[model samples]
Target: MFPASKQAIGMDLPAGMTLLLTLGVSGLILYLSIRTSWIWRHLPPGPTPLPLLGNIMEIGRSDVANSLKKFSDKYGEVFTIYLGSRPVVVVTGYKQVKEVYLDKADDFLGRGDLPAWNNFYKSQGVIFTDVLEWWRELRGFSISSLRDLGFGKSGTEDGIQEEAHCLVEELKKTKESFIDPQLCLRKAVCNINLSTMFGNRHEYEDKDLVVVLSCIQNTFAAANSSWVQEKANPNSVFTRSHLLSSALQIFFAGVETTSTTLYYSLLILLKYPDICAKFQKEIDHVIGPNRCSTIKDKSSMPYTEALIHEIHRFIDLLPLGVPRKTVREVTLKGYKIPQGINILPLLSSVLKDPTCFKYPAEFNPENFLNEKGEFQKNGAYMPFAAGKRNCLGEPMARMMLFLFLTTIFQNFDLKSSVPFEELDITPLVSGFGNLPRNYKCAFITR
Candidate 1:
């Protein structure tokens, strides 16, 4: 019906052909770009993630502490890595970490909020809230209440003395080392925290207490440094993501860290017989025979006080510590890290900074004591962290540590099954907090 040229032209699909051509070209470009692997190119170089799964696949189910340490060794202090599309910036060493924690403290005040937390944690816990102003206010209130409840003074020391007696009694029940020392320490310290927090002393065998502690412990394994690393968002604290992180954060951060710290201190003291002897002699000389170590005696026993400080510094609990998010976009080390980038303050690294401490690797109390034999405070010795967000339970933890140590030593001669080096200082690969490996010792009656 049409002319020969017109009929032939009609066969050429103009619009459809052009659309098809454009789509084809775009698809090719996207495929090339994705296949190019830009994470390696743009991100800080370290572990190369496989497609889809990321570094998580390669690392398997390793504890957060060991994996990060491994990465730190390969990458310089502030290398960036990815976990399932999430960007993680690792900051090792004292100087770089201090900059983020202290210098840009204002910017790095927020906690991380992650997806799994919201899905699971019910997300109303105090620590996970995204509101900084409210958080500081509440944290301050809680700390004040805790202080009023006998935290740093002789008021709480009385409670600690009672708990230590129970611990010694519990150990006496186990003549031979057949028990999980974990259970003993956990039960003992758990009771102390319960009494301190709620003014109730539930029996050690209380099923409810065990269940609650277990819930917190299991949650800690899942939601520790990795959660902080993942959330890394100050605003998220208001959201469910951070609520879960914060709720679980407090229980684990407070009880487990403090308790494990005590466990290690005991282990170290038990292993170093000569050190224990020196500590005991100092305590005896300072506070007379038979009187348990009290908060009042802290000034008199400078060596004992230094010993406790040294234990905290040397154990270096929580290698990665807590990850602090930038509240505002700030310039750090000439790099403009946009708000919400993960900033880790290696509190342990600072505690062991070579320039700050005499023997970075060795356990020495002299680092804490000066020529006048007074307890010298250094910025580097930050177990509770530093600045406005320093640990709320610091006063409580210090009091408990001192009282617990003094009580146990006052009653028994502690000894470890393994030698000092042989004893496992290696934390269980859980998260930032280095949980002590399972080991045992005898609590010989003094």
Candidate 2:
């Protein structure tokens, strides 16, 4: 009788445990559903989010750009999307982007939530800081100091010209053999910033230069800039940590974007040899091969300028510009967005908007050219993004693109074994950058 009773008890315990486990899961699902609904109750309508998971599945891991486009099409220009339970207000189209970023710039000056960057930077850098005053001081100091040193001006042209000459010499070593240009171009572009910041540039083979390049790729860069060290203000935001972070921001953001653009420009030119020939023609007529290219020459070479602008538009390097957060509650397009909600300015939509460009989807330099073949500015052209918080490196990047490209073409002609039709120019979209696919091409001396 005792043995039978023990068996009965064991059987009942197992049944009870199974029922309890089922109820616990169901209760958790209910709680999450209610919480998610309450969180996004007043936000703009968007794709339904699942409990715990949010809309990550719908957003898809790799197709975030396309997902945002699809959501905007269904929910209108201003819509909401969940990135792992965090609601991001995605603003698309030029009209809506301009309104949110430009019209309400002050209200949305707060840095948006970026979990990865936030964790690493700990809100120390200018790019990721939510402390508005600190960001202003650093930004002001950086711009003024860099400008004084000739960044984005003729002051830096001699350095760039020297580096471009080195690049041509390096490519000349390839002896017209197909070689990867990524390393050579990256080093050359990075040297421009290094020379400005450190007052010296490294030889391409220098061990320290390799280390610095590695650091830049891994969310860090050297910060021995004289400006940062010269101004000692222990009480101010110019602490060692903050200054180092800012320098890292400049190198990482500036070098990667500029080099990738130059790489894409080469790829695009390789794909369109006729355009390449035209660039050479313009370079010959305006600057000529004997002299180094300068910022002033940009005015005389409309075709070259137009092509570079088209590259920026065509590549859409950063489809979604750095996210911004609402500093205060603001009403936009009849939607009442609460303060602190993350905002994603869909730059790709604006860059590719049908109304903005005649050939927005294709690589056509005519987008920035008139019937007279002179470069013309388009209001929709916001490749570096629009508003006050747009890329601080814009001037430097523009200068580099013009100088590096003109110098390269002036010295060497692009030769690729890949047939024009077979050559793929589509950008390989990474997390935040649209990278050109790896290919080998020869640089024959012109």
- In TM-score terms, candidate 1 sits at 0.76
Candidate 2 yields a Cα-based lDDT of: 0.84
lDDT of each: 0.69, 0.84
lDDT per residue for candidate 2 within 1-446, as digits (tens), equals: 44577767667667879799889999999888888779669998988877777788887456467778988889999988887778899999998888877888998888888888888888877788878888788889888877887887666888888898998888899999998898889899889888886678888888777777777634342345443553566667887678778778878888889988998888899999998999999999998879888888988889999999999999899988889999899998898999899999899899999988999889999999999988999988898887777788898888888889999999999888788788888866544667788887899998
Q: With candidate 2 superimposed using the best TM-score fit, by how many Å does residue 90's alpha carbon deviate from the native?
A: 0.6
lDDT of 1: 0.69
For each candidate in turn, give its C-alpha RMSD to the true structure in angstroms.
9.8, 4.0
Error of 1 at 409 (Å): 1.0
**Model 1, span 232-333: residue lDDT tens:** 456443443443445456555667877888888877776677889988887667765566667888888888888988998888776667666677777655
